[model samples]
Target chain A: MSKRLLFVFAALIIATMVLSACGPKASTYECTDAIGCVTVAPGDPIHLAYDMVINGPDATLGIDSRNGVEIAIAEKGQLLGHDVQLTGEDDGCSAEGGQASGTKLAADTTIVAVFGTSCSSAARVAVPLLSQAGFVIISASNTAPDLTKAGDPNNWPGYLRTAHNDTIQGAAAAQFAVDFLKVTKAATIHDGSLYAESLANQFAKVFQELGGTITAQEAVDPNQTDFKSVLTSLAPGGPELIYYPIFVKAGSLITRQAKETTGLENTSLMGADGMFSPDVTAGAGDAVEGLFVSSPDTSSFSQKYNDYFLPKYQELFGSEPVSIFHAHAYDATWMVMNAIEAVAVKDADGTLHIPRQALRDAMYATKDFQGLTGVLTCGPTGDCANPKIAVYEYHAGEYPPIKVWP
Target chain B: MLRTWRQRITIADVVVWIIGLSIAFVVVYGSIKTIEVGKYNTRVWIDLTITGLALGGVYALIALGYTIVYGVLKMINFAHSEIFMSGPFTAVFLALALYKNGFWNSHPYISLLLVTLLAVTVSSTLAVLLERIAYRPLRTAPRLVPLITAIGASFFLQYAFRGFFGSGLQAYPELGFLKGTWTFGSIPVYKTQVVVIISALIMMLILYGFVQLTKMGKAMRAVSEDKEVAGLMGIDVDRIIMLTFALGGASAGLGGILYILLFPVVHFFMGFIPGLKAFTAAVLGGIGNVPGAFLGAMILGILEAVGPSLFLDGMGIAAPYQLKDAIAFIILVFILIIRPSGILGERITQTKA
Candidate 1:
């Protein structure tokens, strides 16, 4: 009974070891998340990483968002009873930058969620990697439409943004032109960025449909400074209004140069949210006066944004909201935290187990999430912006542009 | 020379010539067709020309850096762009502070001069430092070694600047005096453009006078002609080369100020594009020739500003400005094909021969 029974017991133990090594565990808490799960040890901080353009020409957009995230963390105090720790890589607001950051961040298994890819071009490369890594990626200022469109190949699973889709923005801009500005003849310039190109295209389409004549649509390199040739090209038609939805550097250059162009003397100049910054006033000098810009309506933000958020943002970052998307970022952070609260499983030992796909599902399930932006609802495609866009007129040397359109 | 070229022409050469001829024909034809269409008025043409001249003036100055450095070292200093970046980037703070204190507007010309001096000093110092740290030790290495080192040094300097001053786009305060336009007879030219163009011409004359009239300039030219021979003849080759970098850096720093007058946003990565264009200008002008750099830069500026509409608008290309770079590089390619040594490159060979 001793030797034979001992050999059989040893064989059974070896078989059990093989099964546990190669297959799924039998007795531990079963993870039903479609992609995967993150099992946090007791007392381990909840990990969140931002992959945004925190350092570049577009820094204000991402830094403002990062500040919002930071303030959100400060406000929350904890996430699922675990200390929330934020870390990030700067996307540099370029495709190569996104690839570098995405490749770097995707390798980490502990990152529960990623908040970033401030630009759509960065998102094009980053979202695939982050999604494949089983992390729910949300952005605060990625407004390109194809990112969350239902059938677009760019619309990857587990990707979402609190930023208004450029479809909404472009349409709003066109509406403003037709209704308020009373511009029949229009032209557009884009910087060839995914965001700028799409926004410009959307504006042109909507403008034409609204019975406005689009004289020309032009594009320039984001890094290029010379816009004389381009602006002159925009002039021949003598369009009453010119819309160039581009970033800060090129936008300022265009804003200044358009005035210098001969036929555009009395023409109205407009740019999108990407150019909405104090930097514009600084860069464009006096040329910025009477220049119109379209951005998410900041006045439509929840009451907390003015009272709590602004003062906290001031205390933390020691400046006014540097860009238009800070509220969106704050909303994105709160949305992520709310999802973590819903999906994170707590253990008796204070350990937190967050199923990766479950967190994404919880985020996708967001509805009427009263955010600083407004009441946000996440659809199947994961767009969660209330999206009230308004056109504003800039006085030279001004920080916040005065709202001119409803 | 024509006979030799004809005799030596191979199938590949024939193909290249055909491609080149077609491009030239297309350009000529497109330009004629644009004039016939006449969408742009004379005022527009005059404006384009003025802008081009101003831009080209800046490019000519920047190209001087590349030409002088290449003339001496016979190696491309890829990091020269960073040197260009370092001067104005550092000087931006001074300009901003001056503006903040109301000195920029009330004492505009003095402020301008001060900013220009700081930019020149910073750029020249950075150039000398770059030559000392990144290029000097690698001088004896394989030619490729120094080239690669220049690239690595370029990255190092960019990131270093980024680390020191956070990578936000810094704005240079505009001079109130430089605002609006000053009338020249019946024509109106922007004060900024006028200043840029006139200063460029004046700077060019000064640089030309320096090279032609100064003993150090002769030493630099001798070193460029033959570094070893010049060294054997008791010329301090290292000193001349350092002088060359300093001269180039000064031009670049001055060029940077001119550049920001047109485009005011300054950042760590700002030098990459203008640097590339200036390098192209150097190559276009015949890399080692001074006047060639200036000539090439002027032509390029005009070509970039006016070429798109003149070359493609009649061709019925929508948004011809979108193809501005394409039009520019194509013209550059044709110019090089017809004259491989560059528009002013013949002098270098003639002197060597």
Candidate 2:
């Protein structure tokens, strides 16, 4: 125990502490794009993260989206010779969860892009944080009209959703009821959610503008299981069609009670993408047999991708995709990858440098890029994919919905 | 005169006056708006009233459990909600099984009876166990100890059930007989609503008779008056307390079945709100008073059902129905502020004092 030996021990402890405290080196990067600067050197993995609902009731939707992203990554062996690594964080389909996941992902500097979130409500909370950090987010599923509409109302400059906005879905529904079904009168109901309320309002407005009378506009507490009184109240109006763009449990109850209730027994029922699930059909039982649902054109994915994607998805996940929007996710993933490759600076030694702002610009510059879903073109507002809405009818004992409208 | 008025009105008093004035203004504004917007449909108003009364009946039954437990123990049995939840949650399995066997649809009344009995039995057993296990050990502890323990027990039961049954909302088996509406001239009353109102009224009457007339009821009253004196008088206070819990549990169980009849979806979180609303009703009625709890529950129920559309809709507030739960608490806050002892609670306190 000499003084020299003790000094050597102290030096070793300090060295260990400093080494453990140090993180990835901060590299200086050449700045060009408007938002801010980001650094990625050669040999660094192109980092991407998915912030979506991976659990809870909407797990199927997010799981399919994740699967699509994985397939896209597999298709691209590497980005500019650097391997691509993807990570996931669950937003739990809640606002608070979105903020938490967004904050965690934003803290990591190396992540060049994000792909998610599955629902509009989650995106509402995540978008501002991610966009402020100069990261581009490409969503495969979020279809709320306000998210990427003109004005970028939520201030998510770097946000883009491949999924079609509910405006198109709601308008398509109104057209089908007004022109095809020839229904003269309609009623719309919402569960007081942003998605459903907006969709219902859009449908009502469109229906009225098209020479169709809106008999009643109603809002119900989603938690209340007994819609009998509400249905009975709405019955006197005797609407030819009742459009409710709500989620599973409440939607199922409405479909069943709307049939059983005295006045609404003959009323035709219509729902939106939220109710277009096997879960809803199972819950509603025979009552949902003839119910119409409007959603994106899921069948429009290219035949080759359809052939390769389904079998490959099955081989990977060991099951069929439970929900729609997988192809949109695949397209979004490739869009992000292609944007990264276009903007990255490659060195002679196989090192890659990706500027965050450049990547965001490249994503916004996407034009008529061939995608599995269809042709993709980035609009001025950052709505990268043009949305096409289709209507499907649920017949009893049918697994997939029967396509009824073009 | 100005000096005198200023001397009487403190800042605290001013704040209270402000809140009171704001609430009054809002209520008045909402009422006028509702009247203007409600389109004067007599039949529709009648239908809403009927639904409110039926819903109130269910609330009354649940409030009784709270009232009885508070009467004897002077502790809010927060876990009593999970007790109410237990019956309907377990009864769904029996209901589902019966539906699978075709007996539910074939012999509807008998199957309903069996389901009610199952719910009551489970609720009673859980209540007794809750008392024996959670509350018994801390009986002599500070009042807060038992109350906190009751809350912990409630969360435990909720999560336990959630784990056991999975977190999905299970729809109650639809009774064929309860689906149709009974028309009284222009006003149509749902068959389920009629059943709920009648059953609740009958159960409350029976409970009143039992508390007034039975031997165990006398012991309960004596113990509630003063446990030491009741013990000195040779009344088995412990037995009376157990009996009280059992009775309260039975009422909650009955309320559970009637509740599912009116609102068929059952879930782990179902008990939390209804249990809380019933507690509010009990407090509004003056917690320890049975008849007061019934009356309070009925008033609460009607207000909750018709208040949103009738009161708020008139004020041009969008989505009034979403604010239904808030209305109940506003009434509670107003009642407590104006009448601290509740509608019937003052008399019982006077007698005891």
Candidate 3:
């Protein structure tokens, strides 16, 4: 009877263990077939990978982040008294690019953690592959809410981002359009990508909730050059403002055509951070004048970034930083460096031992870490930075956009 | 009635019928819904018609190039769109230079005329060059050989243009005269649209006169009908073919400029869709028929402009603009299934045969 009771007890224990494994908690240390854990050995250099948009239309977003990461590495000198090496891969700012970059990075078990993915679409494919391999990915400028959160079914536990979510930017844009501009009728346009679509939807929802009527909601093909018909179709409704949060090319076309379109000339034109670049000004020429853009709060950035980093960056690169997210990238790199140091095990034999799981844990436990962008305290779902969205208005032939809101 | 229809139908016929019925259902359903929606009134309808006509005018000009090429070669010149693109992409530099020098403002008419002349000349030269280099060599090869060569040449020219003039989007300098709307009786027409429509119409008339009345046009018609027989009869088939290409190229270049005028943005990839729509217009009108291309383009432009709002908006569809491309292609499929020989049927081809 006792023996029978022991067998039953053992069976119950086994069942409990299996049940717990299948529970709601995300798998952390489990070595999945797709991605196995990587460990650091003595005298071996710690590997950090960067997957970002290095070429194509949105190259500025990635280039800025890469510069920031390089600066951070220069400041750190080394990690855990061992040399740290970075492998750069281009995400191309597309899903296929992300999958290709992620696949390449995952196959290399030496890489401890990744800092990347300026665009959210790239991160969507990359985070999962990195997560499965038990590698932590920290993004500098992935604003799509689902990248590091549960709302996106593909969200992995290994993904953490220092960038503020679109929820804040979208809401702030809606508030500005309604409260500041005092426009009650508005239309939102998206390019159907997760980044643009989510931001546009959020803006529409908030705009409607603020008692402003949403005149129209529209989506354009990213490849579409002409927006005249779409604009004309929406014109009779007489939207007071047209909020198009899309890329530079499409955004420029829309802005230029909106001014030229018969009924749409008086309608205010606004864009999101996707259009916040020199490219828009260059593409739209004089048409982009008086355009409003919602972007990350530049006023909150530390003066050190301006006084020291700016000149240093110009001196090193022979040009100004192309776009925003450089400071966020700098902050993300330091967080990874700090996390690595906190969990690193150094032995008397001149060998350093860095466990991948412990390093991820250290990153999540990050609190009150003073960074260039903000005082970051990583939340449960890996959102570290507080929301700070600002709106800027562009003047014709201007280099820096004029800040219009706090 | 169903049994009678089925008894007469072959597998191909049945397949076509199914596709036709499905398309008809969607279009009918959407149109009914749109008509019921009170938001779209007569003013909106009038505005959409103007917009469609302006777009169709440009498409018709581009379609002329395809019809001419097809008339002589009996092959679709897929690269003709790139030929159309090269003109406006190159003309922007002249426009920018004129604007900078204050010539654009001081002599707007002369400046516009000069820009058009440059675009037409360059486009004609490129078309002649394309014939000599890409098409001439492959003329004697299999039908597929020249077709493939045309496709390759199209991509090469696009990228080569991109390399020459950077990939960034270039905006045409805003003409002061074309800035505002020209209101005619409660209906307001944009100045740019008026310019595009009038210019396109004038160009089309000149082209029609050139093909119908000129000696070179007679030679082109002869080469298209029987190249060997025309050659035997002392007609220079090669020269006529090159001349035909030049005419198509000139028209395309002008079309590109008008396209830029209407939209005010120019890029290397600008010609691709317009080129495709022109080809569709050509096929819809009858590939070898010039007047048929014009008629088809007008129909296509109007349908694409008003179809979504008129058909889908009343159905309570969300973001109907997203399906605009689908609407254009659906019409293309309908035309192909219903009248494969196009609106003019094989009458144009039989004239040559």
Candidate 4:
């Protein structure tokens, strides 16, 4: 009996080792180019890196963006007759970690391009280093206006993004408040971060431009739980709409507090892309029933994304992709590969003479390239002039796009 | 001989004095300038102070836990922070379960009370168990061994929670009973803030009474003074140490619930910074000194919330707002450098005496 037990244990150990070795291997893509006369052999692997700090592992936003990148890489096959390799790092969506990760990526010569940094703060830290290193950085969800705008030529150069900046989204939100909701008086609130404050300011500016009277502008600490005072001060005015361009955590609390205090059952509360998540719905519960938000429509995007990449992602990660950022990341990988292919040249010696700087420049020269998000054309400032923004309303515990703004 | 030495201070003393004075001057000047600039906006100051105080109450509660544990064990309970974090996670889960059962939505106060009790009981029990499993065996081991083990335990608990709860921030449902604001003069005081301050003060008073008036408190004091001596004097030193950890853990649990009530977003690694700040407060208040920890927490809270607007505001420096961690660390360094023994630490005894 003892001999039999030892044999069984040894067999189990061997089986476990064999099963572990059979785990999914990293997928590779190869892009080959044939010169006028000769066919070039496969070159070195094309490296693509993605950086992001999701709210946590369960965040659908990061998953969606990551899935988008994976699909794009899979479709590219390869670059410059080389296998395309991809790696990702989490910046936790903070400025410090973003800078560190950006510096580390810049130091690595293997990395040709990067798709990342869903949060604007992360982009602010990365754009300078990556641009100086002549690497292409394409953000799927960074919407800070100052980043893409040529206002500070010294700061941003090779930075590009597929998502609409806060300028466009904020204006669309303001228009929705004025036209759809018919709100003449409005108040704006922000969490004092660059993303929140900038979007809030832009929304306030646009709302005022549209002949809407601005009643109040308040800044709350992001760590703060209570907004009773701020809500109370604005409650008396009974503004037709309260615009909040903050993240899910704070946004949910403010929504609940605003409803409870102001009894604003009819006073429309509007939010931006930051609050456009299922987490917000869960956090605010019934308080988010009538909440309105403006961002890229994800319902259509989710279907297309799942159709092409769901099987691959599931086979590897054992989970379905979540969030719109992943889709943008997938498109970003394709954009980089296309640019590399456009500039790569094969020499007589059977070696590929690809200048990274030339590839970066070609990325800027991309015109009318249709992407997963929308039609993309890299403008002079490296901002993709994708003018599609949709207004979503939380109904039946899901955010459904009510209107697509022009 | 003393007069000669005093008149001719060492160069090292001069350098230390300069560094300390410079930092103090900078902090003082910055705070004064910010307040002066915002003097016209009294409401901002009021708003800043109220927010600071509310957060300070929670800090004080957590700091008390660290101080009490340190007082008896003479070892930093690095896992205490994770204990604080677990309270909110447990409370939120309990509240959600109750809400789903139609118990919470109907009687919010009863649900809150029950959740608080549950959190305290669980946290205290976990604290005692952790001390026994992770630290008791290493009690006579090199001090560094237990300290390192404590840190490992902290990380273990954090990742364990993350694995169990899913890494996303879980939002606590709003309690209608804890909603609304009280207006005093032109300033608006949140009901949550009032509750946090009242509860913290009441808990502190009870703690102070327990330490000073109770027989178990006397035994604790004896153990803190000299564990072996207390054991020889008929005190169960081991029992006192366990009780100390339980008491501290209970306070931390209460703090966690209050924090969630205010912030609503609870996560796995949420206890890290707050734990560090609470530890800093304990050090600043003279670790083992309960009242001092409370004072340190209040000071740290005010500096965090009001420091940027009051000090950095005038320089056109928009507070990074996220640099609260940086601010807390700088204060901790300053305290260590200027007053290593803390604000109320006892002087070392002379062997000759």
How far residue A26's Cα lies from its native spot in candidate 2, in Å, is 12
What is the Å distance of residue B171 in model 1 from its true position?
2.0
DockQ of each: 0.63, 0.23, 0.38, 0.14
TM-score of chain B of each: 0.96, 0.94, 0.94, 0.92
Show where candidate 1 strays beyond 4 Å.
Answer: A1-27, B1-7
lDDT of 4: 0.75
Indicate whether candidate 3 or candidate 4 has the larger lDDT.
Answer: 3
Residue A268's lDDT within candidate 3 is 94
Each model's fnat? 0.65, 0.17, 0.43, 0.20
Best by TM-score: 1
Question: Candidate 3 has which clashing residue pairs, if any?
Answer: B30-B311
Docking class of 3: acceptable
Who wins the lDDT comparison? 1
lDDT of 3 by residue, B1-353 (tens): 99998888889888888999989998898888788777866877887888888999899999989988898889888899998989888888999999999999999988888888888888889999999999998898999998999899899988998889866677778777777789888778888788877877787678777777998877777888888999998998888898889989999989988887776677777788898989999989888788788888888888878877887898898888898878988888887888899998578757656
Q: What TM-score, computed on C-alpha atoms, does each candidate reach?
A: 0.94, 0.85, 0.89, 0.75
C-alpha lDDT (0 to 100) for residue A95 of candidate 1: 91
Superposing every Cα of model 3 onto the true structure, what RMSD results?
7.8
Which is better, 1 or 3, measured by DockQ? 1
Q: Quality of candidate 2's docking, in CAPRI categories? A: incorrect
